[model samples]
Target chain A: MQTNISVDLGGTNVRCALVDENGTILSIVKGSSNPEKGAQAIVDKIESLIKQLDNYEQANAIGIVVPGLIDQEKGIITAANNLPKLIDYPLKKQLEQDLGKPVILANDVKAAAYGEAISGAGKEHAIVYYISISTGIGGAAVIDQKLLSGFHGFAGEVGNVIVDPHYEAIGIMNAGAAEALGSGTAIIRIGKEKLGQQIEHAGNVFDLAKQNQKEAQEIVEQMTDHLSTLLSTIALVIDPSIIILGGGVMKGKDVFLEALDQKFHAKIFDAMRDIRIEEAQLEEPGIVGAAMLAQQSVSH
Target chain B: MQTNISVDLGGTNVRCALVDENGTILSIVKGSSNPEKGAQAIVDKIESLIKQLDNYEQANAIGIVVPGLIDQEKGIITAANNLPKLIDYPLKKQLEQDLGKPVILANDVKAAAYGEAISGAGKEHAIVYYISISTGIGGAAVIDQKLLSGFHGFAGEVGNVIVDPHYEAIGIMNAGAAEALGSGTAIIRIGKEKLGQQIEHAGNVFDLAKQNQKEAQEIVEQMTDHLSTLLSTIALVIDPSIIILGGGVMKGKDVFLEALDQKFHAKIFDAMRDIRIEEAQLEEPGIVGAAMLAQQSVSH
Candidate 1:
C-alpha cells in the first residue's frame, strides 16, 4: 500500500499530488510553473508544490511527466520548447535531491497512455495507443500496462507523422505532418485563412462548421482526412487493440468525429479496420499515469 | 543442441529446413507447392519436404511461415491469396497432427523480421523494423526478439498506408496506398504507361533511370518520395532502432538507395534523424526466421 507522488509539469502550470494504489489523488497542490524563468526555478516550484501536499512524506516514489524528448534511462529532458532550459537538464537528479525520494521521469503523453491502459477506457485491452490533439499533437503506446519506450525514447511521436503530401510545413515538423494538418493550432491557422479577423480558436472553426459553413466545413473535412490518414498509418504499423483520443481538439470532435471515423474506415486496411478509436476517459491522466509510473517503478 | 523444423510456404514452392539453435540450416529440402491445388495438397507437400530433411525427426519443434493473414494464437491461416484455400484453415493443428510435432505459424514477413531481429542485421538492436519491397510491399516490427503481432495480427501491413492523394487505386487498397505507388507491381504498371509497352519488372525501370532516362527517372523519383513518406510515417510512430529493407526491389537498390535515403532524411523528424535504414543481412530470412519462431515456441 505504498503511496506515490506524481507531478504533471507543463509550461503554464504544475500539479503535484499524493496518489494511492487506486490512482486516487489524496492531497493535491497546484501552482504556476512559469518555466520560461529556467529549469532550476521550475524544480523549485515543483518542490514547493509538493510541500503543500499533506501526505507528501508518506510517498515512496515520485514520477514526473513532462512534454518533450525525455531520456528516460538517464532521467533527463533533452528538448522542450516550453521549458527550453530543460534541454540536457538532470531534472530527475535535481528533484530527487530536493525531495529525498526515488523518481521516475517519462513523456507526458506516454504517462497518460499508461494511465488509460491501467484504469481508463483501455483497461480491458492488452494494447492501447493514445493520441492527444491540442495546441500541439502528442501520442504514446502502452503494451500490457507498460509504455513502449522505443530506442531513444521517441516511440509514438506521431504528431510529426506526415498525413498529406500537399500541406505546408509548420514549426520544426516537416510539411504535411499530422500536427501541421490536424492539430488545433493548424485548425486555427486555416480557419483564419477562411475567415480573416473573425476566427479566434479551434472552437470558432468548429462552431462555423457545425452551422454548415462551406469554407469552415471544407477545412474541417481536410482535417478529418489528415487525422484519418495519421490513424490509418498508425493502424498499419502498430495495430493496437484500441486508440484513445484526447486533448483540447476533442472539445470540437463532436463536429467531425463521425466524418473522421468514416474517413479512417475508408482508408484503413481491411485487416486493421477493427481498431477502436475512443475518447480518453481519465480526468487527469497525466497526473494519474505519472503515479502509475512511480508505483510500477518500485519493481523496476 | 536442439534443432528445429522450419518450413517456408511460398506461392510456388515449399522449403523445409533443419535449423540449429544458432539458426544455421543443417539440412534443406525444396519442392513444388502448387497452392492452386488447395490447402490440403499444399500441407501434404510441406510434410513431404520435411521428411526429405535429414534431421526432420530429430527436430524438437516446427515453424511454418506463410504469405497470408495468420491467426497465430488459434493456429489458423485466416486469409491468403497465394494459398487461397488456406482461408480459415487450421494450418498449425492439421500440420502438427500430420507431422507429429508441435507447430508454430506466422506471417512470412513477420517471420523474416524475427529472423533479422534474432540473428541478422537487427541482432544488436532492441527494436527492428523489416520492410520487403517486392511485387507487393510487406513489413514487420520485432521488439526485443519478439514479433509485435498487432491486435488482428495485421501489424506492419504498411503497403496499404496511403502516401498520396492524387494517385489512382491499384487494388483493394485505397487510392494512393504505398503499394499503389511504390511496389514493383505499381512500377511495372506505371512503366508501361511511360514506355508504351510491356515492362517485365521493377529492375527495368531502375536500369533506365540509371542511364538517366527522364521518364524512368521521374517514376523512380516518385517511388522514392512515396517510400520516404511511408518510412517517415513509420519513424514517427515506432521510432525503431533500425529498419531493414529486403525483397526483389532491393536487387535494384544500388540505383535508388542514395536517393531514397536523401528523400527520407529530408522528410523525417529531426529527433528521429538517427534511425538507420539498412539492407537485410540474411540471404534466406524467411526460412531462418521460421526456425527461430519454432525455437521460440518451445519456450512459450
Candidate 2:
C-alpha cells in the first residue's frame, strides 16, 4: 500500500504525519509555522518535517493543509488571515521542489472534511457535512462522493451566512454565522467580558457551565440556540445523510451536544426530522484528511 | 432539431410551450390548473395543451415543472404545498405513459436556475446562483456544470438560512432568511398591515415607495437590507461567478436592485468583491429551465 506525508499547517504549529493509504498514521512529527520569521522560514519548517519522516521510498505524495481562502486548482494560498505572508504563495510548487515528490494542497477545513468523509465518522454515509466549531466555525460538504467546491473554490462557507438583518447596521456583522455565536473564540470573548479574569479558555468556560456558573450557562445556552438554528438551516437545505461535528469545543461536551440536538429537532421542519447528527471519529482529522486528499488526487 | 413540450404548472394557471434544441419556443399555449377539480383534471389540462402544439412528430420529450419537493431520481413529486394530491405521485411515469415519450420532472426553481445558467444571464458561467424573489425567496445553485441536489434532494433551500436569532421566537422564524424579509408573501403581509390594503403587489409597493410613503420606503429599505445581507453571505461562502436575480417581484423594481447591490458590496469581504450580480433574462425562466433539465437528464 502507498503511503503519504500529511501536514496540517497553521500559524502556530505545523503537524506532520506519515499516513498509510488507509489513513492510519505510522509515525508523527511536528514543527512551528512561524509567520513572523517570514514565508521562507515556514517553508523550511515544512521541509524539515518532511525530512524527519524520512521514508522517502515509501511515501509517494505530500499533502499540506492550510487556513484561509485557497485556490485549490492552482495550489496557491490566495489570502489567509492567520498567515499574511502566505498570500499568493505557490505552495504546491514550493513543497514539491523542497520534498522532490508529488504534492497537493487544500484549505485546512476542506481537507479535514474529506478525511472525515473517507475514513472517519462520515465513511458510511453518501452525503456528509463536516463542521469545525473551534476558534472559528468552518464547514465542508461531500455530496455524491465529491466535494462541493463552488465556482471560486469557496463552497461550504457556512460560517458567513447572516443571522441578523436588523443588526447589520450596528456593525454587528457575522451575527448569523456559527463562528460568531458558538465558536471557541466567541465563547472566550464573551467569557472574558462576563467573567473577567475568572475564565481563561473556552474549555474552562465549559467547566464553569458544568459547575453551574450562571454566566457560563447563559453563554452556553446562547451558543446552543445559534448552533441549533444553523444546523436546522443546514438540515433544511442539504438534508445530508449525516452531520459530523468536530473541533476543540465538541471534543468532550456531551451536555452541549444534547442541548443542541434538542433545539435542532424543535426548529427543523417535519420532512427533515430523521437526519442524523454525530461527532467525528478522528484524532487528527485535518492531518488524515490532507493525506487522503493527496492520495486521491494522485490516483485520479 | 428535436423539440420538447415544457409545462409550468402553478396553482392559478398552466403555461405550456414547444421548445427546440436551442431553447426557442416554437409555439405557446396556456390553460388553468384548477386544483379544486383534482390531480387527474390538472393532468388532463396539461395533455390538452400538449395536443394544441400538435407537432408531436418532432417532439421527443416532455418536461413538467411544479412547486414542491421533488424526488428527481424517481421522477416523483414527494409533496406539493399547492397541489396536495401530488404527494408521492409518480408524475414522470404517468406523463411518459400518457404522452408515449420520455418525461422529466423537476422543481420549478431548479428549472429556472438551469435555464439561466444555460442560456440566460448565467451563460457560460461555471457557477451560477439563481434566486426567485416571488411569493417566497427560492434559490438554486449550478456548480461544476451540475445542479447541487443534496442527499434528500432539497439542496437549494437558501431561504431557510437564519437571518435573525432573536426574532425567531416571534414575528418570523429565522429573521435573517431572505424569504422572511424580502419574499412577496412577507411584503404583502407587512405592507397591508403598515401601508394599508392598497398595496397589493410588490410592484405597487415599489410605486408607493417612489411616492415617498414613509411606511412603503421603510419596507423596501428593510427588504433591501435583508437581501443584501443574504447575498453577501452567499458571496462569502460560494463566491459564484455570477448571481442571477429573477421572479415576478424583480420585474419592474429597479430601485430594489440598486439598494441590494449597494448593501451587498458594503457587506461582502474584500477578497470576494469581484463577483457579478445581474438580473435574469429568460422569459418564463422557470418553464425554460424545466425543459433544459429534462433534456440534460435524458441525454445523460
Quick one: best lDDT, which candidate?
Answer: 1
Q: Candidate 1: where are CA atoms >4 Å away?
A: A34-41, B36-41
Q: Clashing residue pairs, candidate 1?
A: none
- Interface DockQ per candidate: 0.76, 0.50
| Span of ten consecutive residues with least summed lDDT in model 1 chain A | A265-274
Please give, for every candidate in the order listed, the TM-score of chain B alone compared with the true chain B: 0.95, 0.91
True contacts kept of 1: 0.81
Best by DockQ: 1
Interface quality of candidate 2 as DockQ = 0.50
Instruction: Pick the TM-score winner.
Output: 1
In angstroms, the error of model 2 at A127 is 2.5
| Cα lDDT for residue B155, candidate 1 | 81
lDDT of 2 by residue, B1-300 (tens): 878779998888888898887777788899988977877888888888889986964777888998887887788888788888767777788788888988888788888988888878888798888888888777877875577676767666777666654444324344445577778877887898898888688777888888888888999998887778777766655668799998888865665888888778777655566678899998877777777777777788
Q: What TM-score does chain A of model 2 get?
A: 0.90
